[model samples]
Target: MASPAGTTARHGDICVGLMSGTSADAIDAAVVGITGAGATARLELLGFGTMPLPPEVRRELFLVFDQAERAVERLCSLNVVLGELFADAARTACRQAGVPLAQVFVIGSHGQTVWHQPERDSTVPISTPSTLQIGEPAVIAERTGVPVMANFRAADIAAGGQGAPLVPYFDWVTLRHPERSRAVQNIGGIANVTYLPAGGDIEDVRAFDTGPGNALIDGVVTLLTGGTATFDADGRLAAQGSIDEGLLARLLADPYLNRPPPKTTGRERYGLPLCRRLLEETGLPEGALADPAAPFSLRQRALDLVATVTAFTARSIAEVYRRWLPPIDEVIVSGGGSRNPALLSMLRAALDPVPVVTLEAYGIDSKAKEAMAFALPAHDGLLGLPTNVPGTTGARRQVILGTLTPPTGIVPRSQGKEGQV
Candidate 1:
C-alpha cells in the first residue's frame, strides 16, 4: 500500500518512538503517523506495544543505576543491549501496526535514563549541570536499519536549561484546549506536571517535577515481595490499610516539593535507599513476602506503610497544584502510576472541585503518551524546529533537541532481526 501523494517524498508519516521511564520496567514503543508539522501536525496512533526487559537485563541495569562500584564494562555492554531491546520494541510495534519497518522514516528513542541531575553538582570544581541517558542512537540505527534521534536532553543543558520537563512542548501543541486551562500530569517513576494556561502559547506553559510517583511506592512493594513482584498490583495492598499521619506529614515537608519549577529528580533522591530506610523505620518484615500472610498486627503495619507512601505521593502532587499552578479546570493524568487505582483515588480526593481525568478522555493511550512525546519532537527536529519550552526547562532560548544517527545502509530494515531480541 503506497502512501498518497504529498505525504513526504520518501517514507510517508510512519515513525516509531521508544521510551523506558524511571521505572526501568519495559520499553514502550509507539508507532505514530505525523503529517504536516508543529501545532497543525495531525497524529495517528497506528499501534503500541510494550517489550518487557528480561529479568537479568533489568537487574544488571539497576546495578549500574544504584551501585557506586559499577564496572565500565557493564555500562558499555548494557548500552548496546538496551539499544537492541529498543530496536526489538520498535519492530514489534510496527509489525503490530501492519506497517513495514522500512517504511517508517525515523525512530525517536528517548533511551533509558540511568542518571539525571536537574541541579548542578558543586562537588565538581567546574560545577556544570549535566544529565545522561544511554542506549546509543547509533546502536539502534545499526540494529533496526533506521535513522534514529536520541540524546534529547544534552542540547538543552548546553543552553543552561535544567534539560527536564521537555514534554511541556508536546502538551502545549497536542493538548491545549481552546476555552479552558488544562494540566497534563505524568506519574511515571518521577511525577511531573505541565500547566497550560487557557489558549496558551508556547511561553504560557510551565512544568516541573512534582515529587515521587510510583518510584517510591513501587520500590517499597519490591522490597516486601522479595524479587517476585515488580509493582503493587492495582494498589491492592495499599487499599488494605491506613496512612500514618505523622510520617506523611514529615515526608510532605520535603524542600524539593517547595522548590520552584525547572526542577527534576530520579533514583538519586527516592530510589531503593529511601525505600529501605522507610521500611526499616516502619518495622516491616524484610527478606521476603512471597506469602505476605503475617500475624494480624504485623500485617497491619506493612499495609500502613504502603498506605503512607501512597498518601505521600498523592499529597505532594496535590500540593504542587495548590501552590504553583494557576486555576485550571481539568487535570489530565498519564504514565504508569495513573493506572494505580489507590493513587488516582487519592489524587481525585486532594484535587476536589477540579476534575481529574485520564488522557483517554482525549482519545489517546495514556500509557503511550510519553512515548509519543519523543516521536513528535523527533519530527520537529527533522523539520528544523524547536520544541523545548524555555520557561519549563529554564533554557535561555528555544532550541532543537537531540542528535540524529542515520542508518548504516548496510542492510534493509525489513531484513533486520525478526523473532529474537
Candidate 2:
C-alpha cells in the first residue's frame, strides 16, 4: 500500500531502532514513524518486538566481556555474528508492523556493549576512557539495505564525556512536563535516571547511572537456578526472603552509588563477578539454590542474599536522588525492573511521599522505550542535528552522535547461520 500524499509530510519518515543492553537478554527493535525534527519532532510507534540472543552467542559474548585475556579473533567474529542477529531483528519488527523493509529509511543500532570504561583507570598504565559496542553497523546496512547509525557513544566520550545515559535527550524532548519536575528512571541491566526540572530546558537536565539494576539480581538468580531461570520472576524470590541489613549496608558502600552525575556503569562492574562475590560472602556455592529439596536453612540463606541485593538496588537509587537531585514531584519508572514488585515496594518505601509510576501509565510500552530512543537520535543525525545532551554525558559541547553506514546491495555472509558462523 502506498502512503498517502501528505503522510510523510505529516507523520515523518519511517525508521527502525535496535538495542541489546548490558543484560544481553534480547535484541529489541522499534519501528517508529517520526515527524518534524529536533525537540519539536513527534514519534509514533509503528511496531516493536524482541529477539532472544542464541545461548552460544551470549556465552561467547560474556566470555569476551569478563575475561582479562579476551581474544581479538573472538571479538572480531562476534561483532559480525551479532550484526546478522540485529538485522534479523529489524526485519522481524518491520514485518510485525506490516511495513516493508524497503520502505524503512534508517536503522539505529546501539549494539551489544562488550565493555565500557567511562573513566580513566589509575591502576592500568595509559588507560583512557573507552567503550566498545560490537554489532557491526556495516553488516546491518548490507543485509537490510538501509542506512544504519551506530557507535553512538564514541563521539561523546571523545568530547570528555561518560558517553552514557544517552536517553536523557529523548526524555528531555518527549517527557518533560511544565508543571512537574520528573525523574525518568530506567532500571535496565544498569539503572540510570534523567532529572527533568519542571519547565526547564535541556541544559538543566542531570542524568547518571545510579548503580546496578536487574543485572545483579538477574545474575544472582541465574547462578542460583543453575541456568534454569534467567531472572527472579516478578521478584518472587526477593519477596519471599528477608533483607539482610548487614549485607545490604555493605552493598550500599559501593563508591559508584555515591558518584555524582554524568557517570555510567555496565556489566563490567555489576555483572557476574559481583554476584559471585555476594555468593561467596553468603557462604553459598554455585547451584546451591537449584535443588528444591535442599535443606531449609541452606535455601533461606540463598533467598536472603537475593533479598539483600534487591534492597541494594532500591537503596542505591534512592540514595543517589537524595544526594544530588532537587526535590522532584514524581519518579516515572521504566525498564525490566519496573515489573518487579519487590523492588518497587522497596523503592516506594525508601522514597515515601513521592509518587512512583511506570511509563505505561503515560501510554508507552516500557520494554520498547530504550529501543525507540535510538530512532530519534538516528533521525536527528540524518538532519545534521546534535542529539547528545552535554549535561547528561559530561561532554564539553553538544555534538551529533553515531556513524552512518549507507545501504549496499551485497548479501551478508552469515545470513543463514544465526550465530553458528
Would you estimate the TM-scores of all the predictions? 0.93, 0.95
Which model scores highest in lDDT? 2
Global Cα lDDT for candidate 1: 0.84
The residue pairs in collision within model 1 are none
State the displacement of the C-alpha of residue 275, model 1, in Å, after optimal TM-score superposition: 0.4
Q: In model 2, what are the clashing residue pairs, if there are any?
A: none
Against the correct fold, how does model 2 do in TM-score? 0.95
Write one digit per residue (lDDT tens) for candidate 1, span 1-421. Answer: 2244544443346778899999999999999887766777677788899999999989888898875465567888888899889988988898888877667767889999988887778786776678888887887887777878899998899898989987887788789887999989999999999998888788888999998989998898898877677787898988997999999999999999898777888888989999999988888766335565667787778778888999999999999888888998999999888899998999999999899999999998998899988998887775678878889999999888888888863322221112110
For candidate 2, the per-residue lDDT at 77 reads 94
